[model samples]
Target: MNPITLEGPRLTFRELREDDVDALFEIYGSEVATEHLSFDPRPLDSVASVIASGIADTQVDPRTVYALAVTLKEDPGLIGYARLALEAHRAGQIGFALNPSVWGQGYGTETVRLLLQLGFDQLGLHRIWGARSPKNAASARAMSGNGMVEEARIRDHVFTHGAWRDSITHVILEDEWRQPER
Candidate 1:
């Protein structure tokens, strides 16, 4: 598959590259970045290794995961990443992260919108879902802002920061997405 480049008002989404390791490290290393994520902050070496592994995995199985580098249109610097992992029966899971410095700037919403369009239109995915810690109000809001509806609340779904946390699961179906705006 060709590398996909999605442009929004302030940000762009493209394929991740080896050169993105440093920027990705910076984003993933931030405490805010790990706030709702499953992982914790770690050394740059470990972060680089993870990025390398993801790149290698994509090379091996293009349909397994489509990881995109989020960048600003003006500066064109790597801010973070958005990914969609294919699951069974034409369904998929969507996820994203951004540098805290760019938080509240609507980049997350734009990235997710583009990703959903690609998943439904290009990838022919029937259903796309996302989940986040219930405590992560920002992420929950971002998901809602991008047309994802809360499907369920998985109680005590994950353990993080030394405690079990509830997870808010959200999903957007292709037919729902095709509806015209009110």
Candidate 2:
């Protein structure tokens, strides 16, 4: 696949590079940002290792992952990341995290919309899904804002932070997404 760069009104999405390790580490290394995530806060070395592997994927498998860095368009500073993980079927699963500094500024909703557009419109995917910890109300609203419907509450779905956590999944079919009126 060609290198895909998605442009939103205020952000740009592209493959993360080795040089982005610092910014990525800043997001992942923070306890506040990573609290609801499956993985714990990572060290700088671990982040560098992951970035090295991700950047080596010359042929990106949309079925596996399209991990992208979410950066501000004007300043080009990395705020966080958004991922579209494709399932065995045609549906794709989306997720994102933002810098704690930018939490309530509508970036989350815009990020979801951009990923949905990339998955459904550019990738020709039929369905796109997202899941968030039941405790994450902000993520719930962001997914809903993008036309995703609550699908299920998967109890004990994932073991994180030494305990089983519940996850609520949301989905939007291609036919259900209403493109913005220009």
Candidate 3:
């Protein structure tokens, strides 16, 4: 798949680049930003690795990960990041994060919607799902608002933050995703 650029009402999603290191480091390393993450990333190499992975993704033919920088359309500055990890159950698994300061303002929801748009509409995928910490109601809401339905709650499925944490899996199939509500 070719590198993509998606536009939302309030943001732009594009391929990650090497120059995004500084902003990515700040967001990924922040305490507030890492609060919901499984682990706080150490800035020295993680950011570079993400960019490198994205670059590598662009070269492959069958497409793997769609790692994008979520930026303000007006400013073109990175505010967060999102990815579609393809090849999961013959579909895609969506994941995203944002600066804590920008939390609860609907950007997360829009970002997820963009991922769905790319996966189902653009990429011709059959199914896509999102897995999130059960405690994060906002994330659940985002998934639901974008036409995903709760499929399961796996108890103690992932070990995060020094303990096993439950996760909620939400999914939307291509046929259902075409509904006007999306």
List candidate 1 segments past 4 Å from native.
none
Model 2 residue 164 lDDT?
93
lDDT of all predictions: 0.83, 0.85, 0.84
How much is 170 displaced in model 1, in angstroms? 0.8
TM-score of 2: 0.92
Per-residue lDDT of candidate 1, residues 97-131 (tens digit): 99888888888888888889879988999999999
Task: Report the poorest 10 consecutive residues by lDDT, candidate 2.
Answer: 54-63
Model 2 Cα shift for residue 164 (angstroms): 1.1
Question: Per-residue lDDT of 1-182 in model 2, one digit per residue for the tens?
Answer: 65768999988998878788889888888898888887788899998876776566536543367888898887676798888878866889998999999889999999999999899888888899988899988999999988899999998988877899989999999888755641
Instruction: Name the runs in model 3 displaced over 4 angstroms.
Output: 88-90
Models 1 onward score TM values of 0.92, 0.92, 0.92
What alpha-carbon RMSD in Å does predicted model 1 have with respect to the real structure? 1.6
